[model samples]
Target: MIPRHFKLLLLGAAICAPIFSSAQKIKAPLPNWQNLDLKADGQFGISTEKAYNELLKGKKHVPVVVAVLDAGVDIKHEDLKKIMWVNPKETAANTTDDDKNGYADDVHGWSFLGSAKGSIQYDNLELVRQIRLGQAKFADPKNIAPTDKEAYKAYQKMVAELQGKIDKAKESSNNMLNVALKFNSMVSKMGSRNPSKKQFADYSPEDPAETQLQKIALENWGTGDFNNFMEEEIYGAMKHYREQLDYHFNINFDSRDTVGDNYADVNERNYGTGDAAGPAPDHGSHVAGIIAAVRDNDLGIKGVADDVAIMSVRTVPNGDERDKDVANAIRYAAANGAKVINMSFGKGYSSNKTAVDDAVKFAMSKDVLIVHSAGNDGKDNDKEPGFPNKFYEDKSGEAAAWIEIGASGYIDDETLAAPFSNYGKNTVDVYAPGVKINSTMPGSKYKEQDGTSMSAPVVSGLAALIRSYYPKLTALQVKEILMKSAVKVDHKVTVKNGDGKRKVLFSDICQTGGIVNAYEALKLAATY
Candidate 1:
């Protein structure tokens, strides 16, 4: 699946490296800024502290289950172990289906990306998969049948887009190589020594290009060793681009056999393993911590919701997620007792939209609230629709219990909207604090990350908070209260639009024209 945060990291290293070279150093935002209020703490947080102090001081609450449908989670994490969902009927690590629910020993949740043998970490993008499946039938225009005209046209478009991506990857790879070479040459000319910032500033360059390169090295690399920077950051990015060409965009690359399921079947539910913590649980673990890490444990950062259970449904891999796995994951969560599902992963294309739509409908029928990240492409989602959206493909209706979120920074001026967040006035419901958010990571550690991936969990945690306190309200009612009680931004904010930045009113980009405020939402929930 496409983790929005990871995609932004690749973009920064690949496409925006040049701009970053000339950029000034930015001060890191204060930790736990996402819970602080703007008026009370001078940060554009969700006012969670205010809600806890003034609204929910002595309130009794039930535990709400929030299903994280993404790249798996570390279920045994120190900060997350006690808050994880446990199957009451099934036992952990047993080879039998104790609960009689078709899955064997699904203690926490299920992993649709794994099998009895191992798990699938990397796979081709959905676009590449489409091209690979259709090449034999639509490779040549002369062999196209009249019934396949539209399909053939779409196939051609996929080819063109794939080629464009390949070309860009190659170009970025070449740029990074050139930069590495320049750094090496500068080092050689300076008697083969990794210089400090003062040394770099004092050294004279023979040419203007070398001078520019030296300035970039000083500003971006700081006093770090040039060799390590080249190996870890520069060459590492080059290797990533190479992988994109060889694996992500490669039509011949397929990893579905690892899952050992019938690839053509859209409704196969008996496959996959019971291990929710797959090979990589970094992204999912961070997301879970943001939602339901134990509060006041004095061990790690507190979560948005105090009383909640995190259910891990691993459907995402290193690449784009399949529609079948996503649909099954949603069904699994809904069939169980997950009142809210947080989807922090998305892609641009959906080969099987009907399956996902039906699963979403199933979740809705079960009174489950689904929250999705808008995306990190910095484009208007209304123009370029993202998958797992609220709209159904059959032109029937939209989901009433869905909340699409965009990322907002801690500042309220030109930097209010996160530069990488995708926005749409009719698509994105609200914004949340996502910039420099510190949370639990794998290996009992913690780190800061930024994206709409981070933003969705903020809203999800808020939703769980509301559901825990107001158990009588339906999922649709919670969605309404969150949207209606959001903190509206009347001033203009600067947002990224493709290659440039533009100033627009917050209302012009999101449906609520504001950020999600927990205090206001809980206050509004009390009335309901």
Candidate 2:
């Protein structure tokens, strides 16, 4: 069980490096692209300009509705204001559930974290609870012995898995410390209060000054674009280093063991209360701005969809999301008329698989499309699975609306697929621009970020584009169109391995092996 206290700390932030693709060399650029994040660039407006010039002039489809499920959105964001999804049944700012669905004045969406206030949510909250319960069940020393031997073996396996996480956390913390120390030393040697790369690089490579600086730059921070160095980037390493140290060395992370309450108790619909101000609204607001923040408004940034509306459902807090909350969020999006849903989060453990899967099934039944981020752990998803997968092992369903996307970059062929993006031909469906992605932050600010979290919203905008222009297609069909029409890359790319090394020929990581092209998807949809 992921404890409540830990959950409060968990919700947050991916890195992308270049990888090899089957396409041996970059001869031609992928053409007819559409959908640049509004928060990213005024250039993204060029993509929208193309959409209008080529596709939108003659189109008459209704505006699309996309739901962003993450931290709460800054409802006051200028770009996000007009398009906010209002519950028609209830009056805004009034203390009545005019819709009478138990939730009061849920004009935009409901916040689940406030109700489960103290409890922390982890990926396998339920699974952890089960393991704990089994341990408590038999006080007898004889009970400790495996009855069928198989029983003892199962327990052993579970224990080993939990122990693996403990090991990894420790390892990660150590690595961060090593990296952080290197950076600290680099700063000390330069003696420059704030050493930008240029000042540091004024020395020659053969010179001890340059050699040491280059090695330090590569080892500590990953890149050396001095001009583009984010405030978050320079300090993020220090932050990561400290946070990991606490996670591993500290005895208490209260969020670690919270899998209590009958998660399966579906009859109890009053799962959470009405505190919409989630612990962190950063990721959620960033996602929300991507899909439907009004474009060409000269505000912080433009969103992908023009006439679309946004449904903000604050479910994720600082850590892993509760199964009950996730499931309910899905149903809420579907019931509230959201045509598309974007989920930019995932965890390895899902204690209440039954509830989680049920929510997915319900979404599919309602024909609502879901876009998910392939986790940022950088391991091949095929070898390391993340929870809330799009397809069941059986592969029985012909049409699955859920999509798992990896990160891409606006850089050249060399930096195409980010080294950190999770890939698996069977698991990751596609890729999108995630490296140095610019989007809306809380407090109505515009900022740059990196992660599959950014990637999911880029595609969500495209999904909204397709659905907006072609409403006739069902959610399942739209998902298929997006995948099937994706521009596949034949380049043999380079990707980072589970160990911090690089590996080649990782093109097969994603089924599509291509960055999404909205223009192509829309063109394909027209035919369908």
Judged by TM-score, which candidate is best?
1
Q: lDDT for model 2, on a 0 to 1 scale? A: 0.64
RMSD of 1: 3.0
Residues 325-378, model 2: lDDT tens digits = 788888888888888999888777665656667778888888899998987767
TM-score of each: 0.91, 0.77
Give a tens-digit lDDT track for model 1, residues 1-528. Answer: 444335324533533354433444555566688998899888889999899999998899999999999888998888999999999999888789999988998999999998976998888888898888889787688978899999998888999999998998788777877877876787787775666567667779886667667665554452257765565566767777777888888888888899999978998998898888899898899999999888888988889999998999998887899999999999999999999999998988888999999999999999999999998888899899988899999999999999999999998787789888899999999999888788888788887778898999999999999999999999999999999999999999888777788999999999999999999999999998
Evaluate all candidate structures by whole-model CA lDDT and list the values in order: 0.87, 0.64
Worst-scoring 10-residue span by lDDT in model 2: 8-17
Supply the TM-score for candidate 2: 0.77
Candidate RMSDs in order: 3.0, 6.6
